[model samples]
Target chain A: MPPTAALSIRDLKFRYPPGADDAPAESGEGVGGWIVDIPAFDLARGEQALLTAGSGAGKSTLLSLIAGLLDPDPSHGAGTIEVAGTNLLALHGAARDLFRGRSIGMIFQTFNLLHGFSALENVMAALMFSAIPPREHRARALALLERLGIARPNADPDRLSVGQQQRVAVARAVACGPALVLADEPTASLDPENSANAMDLIQSVCRESGAALLCVSHDPSMAERFTRRVGLRELSAAPAAVGG
Target chain B: MAMTDFQIVVRSLTARRFSTVTTIITVAVAVALMLTLLGMKDAARRAFDRGSGNMHLVVSRDASPLVAILNSVFYANPPRAPLSYAQFRQLRDELPVEWAIPTQQGDSFRGLPVTATEPEFFTRLRPDPDREWRFAVGRVFRADFEVVVGAGAARQTGLRVGDQIYVTHGTGTVAALAESAGARVGEGAAIAHIHKEFPFTIVGILEPTGGPHDRVLFVNLHSSWIMHAHDRRLASDPSVKTTGAADVTDADRLITAVLLRLLTRPGQDVTAVEPVVFDQLRRAGGFTVAKPAQEIQRLFAIVGGIHQIFVGMAGVVLLSSGIAIMLALHNSMEQRRRQIAVLRVLGASRGRVFGLMVTESAVIGLLGALAGVGVAVVGQQVVASIMRGQLGLVIEPTVVPAILLGVVAATVALAAVAGLVPGVMAYRTSVLRSLKPLG
Candidate 1:
């Protein structure tokens, strides 16, 4: 029998409305011009996986779908995304948001640390929605910032170097001890040396917390760092990708 | 412990100091005006009430009730035709008069009205039947040339017990203007010059009453009569008797008005006395009766119309300040879009975002209102000073807690409403587009 997957996506299909004003045109797998079609994807507990895709290949959309930030179209889409035994697609609205906050963490390319908050405060902000006790929030946040090698935990994010800011983002993402951490090209803006360092820090932190890591990157150097590599074209290919 | 959302709000406001201060000042000015207008309305009504006193009726020459009341009680407005001193005596003898005080106007000292009456004026008159006038210092006039100054008059002139001031026989403004203009041949006008020959010493200073009495000078009736009679005696003969107060004997002594307080048995209805007194004055032909309370109410009706206009203008100012708050939040929201999306990604629900915005506006409004109440109190005092100096109308600005509380509640409600549109828009902001990477 297969090991239980910490993150799973099966028989998924999604389509963008034709010429919709706010829609970004995604032309990949054309199952009646569906924007996304994937089948049988899984990440074992504490596994690290990398996904590579060119522009408009539905990389960001897939990340959004897994994060429960976007709702799948019921008419053309039929799928279940389960993260840590909870089916994300089954939840709706605020409930989905809460599950995402408690069980899933996201890292962005821009190192989206709140400008007004310090390095420690940015991590503490994530714990506010978690089940962590209020008394432990500051101590936990301080400990994480120290572990991430941030020299100035109380320094404002705007004053931090690019590499330090990325580390702070990583600390924030894993602060809640979420079951899965999604990284959307987190090192896109960093140099090769800093990029390698950022990836190592994210992977090491996830491993220590026993959280699964799914990262999307265009940089070829990142492919060797992950235990598994998958192509967007492979995930979007026809028939069997939709359980046919 | 987790940092409260309020801490974030305060940080955001202080980070943008200019907008916060401008919004507060806008709200402060609007609130000050609202309090000033409302305070003036209340104080004006009270001043009229204090001046009404125990006397219910005023007897004067036939004229409008407003003219009669203003001339007699306030010693303001143009002097009405005089009622004979003999006629006042006749009414005192025939009517159920407990006491009658005859007052002659048409004279002033340093812009304060000079009222001439017998010594009974102070001893008998009471603001309420239970209370008589109290003096702050010294004693009432005993000698004919001695005078008692009201609290306001003393404050304005800085006069003490020994300071002597000459009364202008006609009106202070007209006499000063004519003397400055250097042309006056009228006999009545010369009376002001004649009175300068005899100056009266200020012997007493009355306590502050917040009434028209606080702005007037009180003197013996014989002193006024002697001054005017001495004008004629000097004009006719070079030598006239000016030895004592008795030399000013009554011949054609006419007074401006008489304030009446009727005698009644303990169980008798005092209100019933007014109609009989009115009828007696009506039968006496040349005289008319005016009720101070009723006439002052009419005065307020006219003044109240002006008050409503000012209140409407103040409401517009307050409403604009609410708009200023709305604009401030809305403009900041544009800069804060990504920050809001970040909060949502961290687990804040849409409702939480909405609440944060509303609370920000409420904080601004509450702070503005508190500052406004303080500004209003100071503004009202300035207004009171001006009214006393220019109009001889005494109005004390007193804080009414209920009104201030109402202002605070209204301001908060206004701020909440102002923030509603922006808050709802923020609640609807799509988290997907905002969080998407360069991909």
Candidate 2:
């Protein structure tokens, strides 16, 4: 009855290699490691949530599943994961990849900007797979960088400071106007000032773009920034917390 | 952020500048080798195709056709038994001839063959009918002791018009014999160098003909008789004398070969009647008949065989270049894993990643091929100059554009194939695994 969820997951379970503990690894048994088990989770359109976890609590694994980087293990897992109405678990391989590129924006912890590209080119490249017309890619990228307070949009990534680089990464993430923004430990390397600035910049940009934010972090202090918060230990269905 | 496939390729290659340059150079060398070899074959064929168009027949004493062509046209190899002056007269009087000019040799001015012939030789000889020999400097030889230098000979000797040059009798094999004969009895058996009493003056320099004709010194046949008599051995015979160009008896006159041009009757095809006349000359038994054109054909066959072998070697080089591209891409795939994973997360399909790798190789191949062609063009200019100066064989520095385009296309295609292994490797890369920190 409420606004449709931007992301929804239910009865989700995954284990690497896939089976019970009794069978041999070759037979897809003990080789399996419990990665994710979520009974239910949802993010309504335009809502922001922060997901926190310890080092080994499968924060990345869960992000990967939602991004369609990894498919849920069919035999040892059962689940439905949907983003913007497309069932993530139902798609496979390139279909999932296209959907991710088209509908989701991802920002990683280390500010993974292509080293050879300029700040503006990095953003434009993201829009290459989007529905944006090629002629407008330049203008859109310039506007995004200008809005993010990047003075040198055409400067190479390495030439920029860490704060500038992180801003470029955030600009590239939202370049395609994706419905969901997934930032994984986006401020892990920043000082207090830079971290706070990066977080403020990311949330404001996502909100303006009307994208729901599902940010992953190992730092519990980050939980205070978001209205909704959940832990990987609770979501992964593990009794004991794993060190991040 | 999603980078386009092309931007990714350019950035990746530019990042490894040294490797990319090496790959491009490898490709360039292979392409240049191939194009040069091809250009050589084509140039050789063109040179021989127009080798001796005016003198289709060489009538001389019995000898191998190849040897006769080499001696008469190229001034190479030893002198054959001189064709009798009587035979020259007979052909002049009886045959339906358009023109017959005799060439006499066995003398040299600074290692260049000195041919004694009538002035008609210059006026009548046309290697290509559209191109006639004109004086680059002065006029043709007019007097008995005057000579005309060919373009190549003049360039090599640095001789200009009005330079007096002494001629030595029998410069090649007979130089020693002539020198020994000229030695005085009291000289203690040391051979004396004989130079004619009257030195010939250079009267003209001929323009380049791009053939063997461009490498000789031409004088009136009378000057040869005057030089031959200077040898002490020939002075005693009384047969050698300083006769005018118009006043020479059969006994005093001698020639090496007679170049014939048969007359074509109206409404009659010279090509059709040529064989019949050739058979008559063969059966007549007084003259040895040879077609320089046919001899050149045999030479082409030998040259063509060598050309094929060299081309095969060039092909091997190109193949190795393709392999080098493959190895370069494959080796870098491991390092590029994180980059590829990042692209996948940005909506690049495995196919897109695969295509990016292949396209990268193709770009390299294209660059290499273009650079190689440029090298070939420049290299040809140098080689052609050497060929003109040394061999008097002009090789055009140009190649067929179609063939060049084909080579470029082939190079790019081979490079794309080279990228396949690396493309597949990137396609199968595990995005999740590569993103994990290595142990």
Candidate 3:
């Protein structure tokens, strides 16, 4: 009867095949050789969580599964990954892509803004796939960039400072007004001062947009800023956590 | 502002400006060369068709029918065997001919072929079936030593109505004739033997007929006979006076060829009687007979092989350009994998990404094809000018819009086909692998 969770996972399990390019070096023998074994996880609407893990821990892989960039082999793993109460595992490739573009926003570790695009265009790129009217895309992107403290919306992303580039990435991530936003080491490339600023900026923007946040990072300091914190080892439920 | 897929493609190309521009130029040069060859071939066919006129057959003393048609109709060279006036008269009286016009072409005026014929040559013959020869400035020549210049001849020689110019004994420029005479160009007396004693006054200039005749100078047959007679007398007796038209005798009356228009039944085409008259002339031993229209077709048939070779070479160039487009896009795929992944994350489907790549190639082709049309137009004019100056063949260089459209469409389609390989590479890109951080 309560509002549906933005993200829900139940009895989910995933493991790369042995000798696969991205297979973990030390596979867990527990639960039939599974790499990632989680009993249950959920993020309520408008909730914020920081997922902390070691360097090889599968924090980014979890984000990839949630974003539908990779599929969990149904034969090897079983469970449901639901976004906004819609089962992501039930959707096909293109349908999943559309759902991800409309319902989820993702921020990468390296501030991967398209090189040739200006600050404004990078933000607008996300809006291109949204249900927003084409006539309003420009105005909405500009408003988001301006609100994010981007002084030169027309400047190339490559020429912007590290902090400014992170801001552009943040603007691009939330441009579609998604239900949940995923941040994968979004401040890893910034120095201490800039990292704090970038973290604050990402959380503030997500909260303003009324979206839940699921951020992955190895930094212990990021834990103080989130309302909820879960370590990858505890979430995996298996004896050994899956290393990427 | 929001960018469309096309705008993104354009920006991507501009980002790698050097490769894009080079690829477009390669395509443009190939397209232009192909279009130019097509234009020249079409122009050459039209020129030959128009030059053949409405005449049914040509009677000359050339070695073959093609040579006879070329020497007699196109003035390509002087005839090797002279058809005497007596033989021409005999044929005129013996064959089923409506009109027999004797033509002499042993001389030239400043490199323009000088054709000596009766006044009927202008009034009777049509350069094309529906077009009549009309004077651009003045009337046709009325007397011996009076001449009518063709439009191209006047333009090239700067000859005007009422200008008197000496006719040379051979088809060479004045400097070449003087050199052959063992004299410098300015040595008037030393070069005198190469020119007629009397000068011909240009009385009219014919309008452009879009044929080889546009580069000729027309004179009366009597004028040629008198000039030759005077030259012969000067060689024997240097003090002999210049001969006039009245001095032209049977011995001096020699013609290179005779253009024949066969007599046909009422409402019948001239081709109906052409074979019959052609056979009679062939059976007779004195004359060489040629069907002008048939010989022109034969000439093109022999030349068509060379044209196909040129077209094949242009096609190879065009194919290479297509490969260049493919290679350019394919080589960039390695660097663009991450960009493709980013677009995929931004919600672009595999089909959309593939289409964008193909559209990029098509856009490049469209641009290059349009630019090639421009280049072809300029190239055609340059080729036409050279043919006119060197061969005295008036080629009407025209760009057929249908051909242009077909070439452009084909080029774009070729380029789009070329893009399929790179498009597949993009479609199959692994979003997660590409988005992973590089070590």
lDDT per residue as tens, model 2, B1-439:
3456788899989987888999999999999999988887788667766667566588877477777777777777435577766778888788777788888877776666788888878887675535778889999877888999998899888999999987655555455555446532224223334565667899999998777777789998777765544443344665654434444455557788888877766644244556877888889986777887888888878778888999999999999999999998888887788788878888889999999999999999999999999999988888888877666676777878988999999999999999999999989888777665310
Who is ahead in TM-score, 1 or 3?
3
DockQ of 1: 0.49
How far residue B229's Cα lies from its native spot in candidate 2, in Å, is 2.2
The list of candidate 1 runs beyond 4 A from truth reads A1-4, A18-31, A150-154, A238-244, B128-131, B178-194, B235-252, B264-270, B436-438
- All candidates' lDDT scores? 0.80, 0.79, 0.83
- CA shift of B249, model 2, Å: 7.3
How should the candidates be ordered by TM-score, best one leading?
A: 3, 1, 2
- Once fitted onto the true fold, the runs of candidate 2 whose alpha carbons sit more than 4 angstroms away are A1-3, A18-33, A76-78, A238-244, B1-4, B61-63, B78-80, B168-196, B232-252, B265-270, B283-288, B437-439
Query: What tens-digit string does per-residue lDDT give for candidate 2 at A1-244?
Result: 1248888877666666533331222321111355677767778888899887656567777787888877776875558888998888888877888889888998988777765778988888788878888888899999999999999998998999999999999999999998899998898889889999999999999999999999987666788999888786666554233111
lDDT of 1 by residue, A188-214 (tens): 899999999999899999999999998
Off by over 4 Å in 3: A1-3, A18-33, A238-244, B172-193, B265-269
Model 3, B1-439: lDDT tens digits are 4668887788778877888899999899989998999888998898888887778889998999999988888888879788889998998898888888999987776667889999989888877766899999999889988999999999988999989888776665554565356443544222323453587898999999888888999999988899888866776798987687676778889999999888877666555777777788888877789988888899999999999999999989998999999999999987788888888888888888899899989988888888898899999999999988777678889878787888899899999999999999989987777877611
Candidate 1 residues B1-439, lDDT tens each? 7656786677667766898899988888888888888877898788787787878788888477788888888777536487778888987888888888898887777667888887888887874345588999988898787899999999988989988877776666566654445444245433343265688999999998777788888988778787877766766786865535555556537688888888766645266677787777777677768888888999999988999999999989899999999999898876666777877888777888788788888889888888999999999999999987866678888868888888878987898899897788778877766655536
Candidates sorted by DockQ, best first: 1, 3, 2
Which residue pairs overlap in candidate 3's backbone? none
What is model 3's DockQ versus the real complex? 0.47
- What are the iRMS values of all candidates? 2.0, 5.6, 2.6
Give per-residue lDDT, candidate 3, residue A192.
89
Pairs with steric clashes in candidate 2: A54-A244, A55-A243, A55-A244, A125-B2, A126-B2
